[model samples]
Target: MQKQADRVVQILKSKGLRVTPQRFAVYANLLERLDHPTADQILNDLNQDAPTSSQATVYLSLQTLRDAGLVREVLLEQGVCRYDANVEPHHHFRCRCCGKIEDIEWDAFEGLSFRKLRAGLKVDSYEITVNGVCDRCQH
Candidate 1:
């Protein structure tokens, strides 16, 4: 946990972002739980240590982190937005029943190409989310 916190601090510093307690706590929480939690979920978890931490603070912290490219937003069903700390080039797998989100390694689709599919449009980046029953939900 300490290592992860330190890494978060370093990332924030590298991005020229102030390393505040709230931001550290938020980033650390996301690192600890790669489940892709929502802002409310993150706030609920943070309240254990920082009862005064407001939803707006978490939201802002998340926005800053996202802008710094340290975090990515995952939009699942019903316009719900979840935050993911893994910024590496990768995809996602969402459990249909439990709505659990897990990382799908980049290598899984390394050979994929869409140059022909996106002939005219300028492609910046892309993310794919596969929905299915996870292992726990399968059983």
Candidate 2:
């Protein structure tokens, strides 16, 4: 967590972006939370810690972090958007029952043939989202 806090500043400076409290707080929160959280959810959590941080601040901070390539935005069902701090190449498994998003390893796709993707012109980046009920929800 401490390392991520410092990383937030380093990444911001490397991207030539000014470091602000709200932006730092937002990124720090994202780093701590492994669960992909929506902007509203993030704002709610931040309100508990820093009362001064507003929705706009959180939204703007999210945009800035995304623009700096420090985070990845996950677009889920029903126009729901979740933020992930792990920017590495990976996929997602979403729980249909509880709306939880879990990261799936990139190596998991190694054996599968991406015929459609391979035939495509060029794929810069891609993320596969699988929707199903989680174990906890299955019961």
Candidate 3:
């Protein structure tokens, strides 16, 4: 079967965005590794093959991808920013011991009535992050 993730990249390109090698590498990295990587982590991972991706390049590429809604950013303890490739209204979990991030299945908003409470408030995004030890670190 064809992959749905590849369609995401195609949609991004059709919007007139330049698909650079570095950007493609970033997307591939995200696809391979589901862990939420900080910009530095992404740089380190990319450096394994692309030994010259400067920190600034990663930041710019992340911004471009995020702006296109292809990626989403999450903040954890101490204002640390982590990135996730799945952007379809999901929750996140962060490990306190190793700072690893994982996606958690949650649908707690099904009964919420935020619009009724605010009377005119427009809610666009939702983020939920829980911090604790991951299974690997506990071993």
Candidate 4:
């Protein structure tokens, strides 16, 4: 766990961001859990070990991490915002029945392109979220 924390710190430093203990804790927690937690959920978990961690700190840290390209914000139905630590080029599979979000392998969309869909619009990044009942929920 310490090694992972150290690597996170190094990554933050490389991104020219300050390496605060609060930030480290936040990042580590995100790394530990890939369930895509909301800011409130993250704050609640952080307060378990760090009572001094305020909501503002977590929010700021998330924003900073997002700015540094270390995390991504996922918006689900009803405008729920969740934080995802995986910054790779992939999509997500959302289980509507249980609100579970899982990573979709990049190879699923390999060699797929949509640049020709529009003429004058420059496409940046795109996210494809498949929503349905997961296998566990189906069973």
Highest-TM-score candidate: 2
lDDT of 4 by residue, 73-106 (tens): 9886677889988989778899989888899977
* Candidate 4 local distance difference test against the native: 0.86
RMSD of each: 2.1, 2.0, 3.2, 2.1
Off by over 4 Å in 4: 110-116
Model 1, position 72, has a per-residue lDDT of: 87
Tell me each candidate's TM-score. 0.85, 0.88, 0.77, 0.86
lDDT of 2 by residue, 1-139 (tens): 6787787789889999999988887888898898999999899998985487888899999999999888888887778888999999988898989977899998777666556665557766677888999999999
Give lDDT tens digits, candidate 1, residues 41-96.
99999997649789999999999989887788888768789999888888899999
Q: List runs of model 3 lying over 4 Å from the truth.
A: 1-9, 108-122, 136-139
The alpha-carbon lDDT assigned to residue 31 of candidate 4 equals 92
How many clashes would you count in candidate 1? 0
Q: List clash counts for every candidate, in order.
A: 0, 0, 0, 0
Candidate 3, residues 24-117: lDDT per residue as tens digits?
6676677677888888999999998649899998998888888877788877667778777888887888888987778877684467556565
Evaluated against the true structure, the overall lDDT of model 1 is 0.87
Q: Model 2, residue 12: what's the lDDT?
A: 86
lDDT, model 1, position 58: 98
Q: Candidate 2, which segments miss by more than 4 Å at Cα?
A: 117-120
